[model samples]
Target: MSEVAVRMRLLQQSFDAFDESAAARLGLNRTDLRCLDLILAKDPMAAGELTTAAKLSPAATTTAIDRLERAGFVTRSRDAANRRRVLVAATEAARAAEREVYGPLGEAGTSALRRYGEEQLAVIIDFLETARRVQEEQTARLKKLPVRE
Candidate 1:
């Protein structure tokens, strides 16, 4: 692999480690942290949308939301435009915590990206999107794989 590819892999691994530590610090399992992240990333996101993004069943998603709710990390509401639909929104507390933990990293990323021109940034975006799709496919395949005894 090229140096860029190797650097990307290392960066990804480092980010995963950061998530693991953050989850532990927040007293959440990785899945719960991931669910919380989805909510925080997309404020006022629909409940079903979160389930789809998290690849969780409706029941499991409910449980995860309940946990976050109990922790005052998120709130659930009936959508005004669609009363039948539930919406998930991150609490100020949660968003504040996220900012506290991730703001510096986000700033650093912005600084790094400033060095790239539009064309280079487009290539980076394309690479990231393609990689994300591949990871999604692989995760789904792994979910369907039979366990060995």
Candidate 2:
């Protein structure tokens, strides 16, 4: 592979390790943290949409929501407009964890970006956007594959 490819692989590995460490420090298992992230990103999302975004089964999603609610990280309620639908929202606890856990990383990244010229930052942005799109495609592909026996 090329130097850029190697650097990208290293970045991904580092990010995975960072995420795992942050999740542990924040007292969340991976799935719960992931669910919380999605809910925080799209507050008051339909219950089914949160489940789909988390790639969790209906039963699993219910349990996760229950767990989050009990932990005060999330709240679930009937949609006012549609009584038949359930909605999930992130609570202040979730926002607090986000700020406490991810704030430094965001700040450091922003600081680093500030050191770059506009042209260099443009290149970085382009690379990051493309990499994210490819990673998403890979995630979709891997989800379709059966687990190893």
Candidate 3:
């Protein structure tokens, strides 16, 4: 692999480690954390939407939501437009926790990026977006494959 590819792999590994640590610190499993992240990104998100975004089965998504609700990270409510539909939203506690855990990292990242010019930042942004798209595409492809147990 090229140096860039190796660096990208290392970056992914580091992110995975960070996610694991963050979830543990918040008293949550990785799946629950991932669900919480989706909820935070789209506050008051539909439960079904969360299930799709998290790539979880309905039952698994329910369990994750239950765990998050119990941990004060998320809450479930009936959607106003459709009483039968459920929505999940991050709680104030979850927001506070996120700020406590990720605020420093965000600040550091901003500081690091300050040295880069606009064009350099644009290139970086493009690379990250492309990487994210590739990851999403790969995840969908894997989900299509048969289970290998």
Candidate 4:
């Protein structure tokens, strides 16, 4: 692998470690925290949508939601436009956690980005988008493979 590939792997590992630590600090498992992140990213999102986004089985998603709700991180309600549908939302506690945990990280990221010019920033954005798309495609490909013993 090239140097960039090695660096990317390290970056992914760092992110995973950070996520685990953050989740632990909030008294949640990684899966539960991930579900909360999905809900926070899209407030009032359908439970089904969250399940898909989190790539969890329906039962697992339900359990995550239950845990988050019990922990005061999330709430479930009927969708206003579709009463039959259930929507998930982050609670104030969850928002506060996000602000407390990630606010400084966001500020540091923004400060780092400030060193780049507009064209450099555009390139960075394109690279990030392409990388994300490839990761999504790879995830789908993995999901299609037969389960191993």
Q: Candidate 1, residues 1-149: lDDT per residue as tens digits?
A: 59978997898999899999888877788889999999888998898999999999999999999999998899999999999999999999898879877888799999989999999999999989998898889888998999888
Clashing pairs in 1: none
Model 3, position 114, has a per-residue lDDT of: 100
Off by over 4 Å in 2: 143-148
Of 1 and 2, the candidate ahead on lDDT is: 1
Q: Order of candidates by lDDT, top first?
A: 3, 4, 1, 2
Model 4: lDDT of residue 11:
95
lDDT string for model 2 (92-144, tens) is 88899999998999999899889899999899889889989999999889989
**Over the full model, what C-alpha lDDT does candidate 4 score relative to the true structure?**
0.93
TM-score of 3: 0.92
Candidate 2 lDDT score relative to the true structure: 0.89
What lDDT score is found at residue 60 in candidate 3? 98
**What TM-scores do the predictions have?**
0.80, 0.90, 0.92, 0.93
Report how far residue 14 has shifted in candidate 2, in Å.
1.4
Q: lDDT tens digits, residues 30-100, model 4? A: 99988888899999789999889998998999999999999999989998889989999999999999998
Count of steric clashes across candidates, in order? 0, 0, 0, 0
TM-score of 1: 0.80
Judge candidate 1 at residue 28 and give its lDDT.
Answer: 83
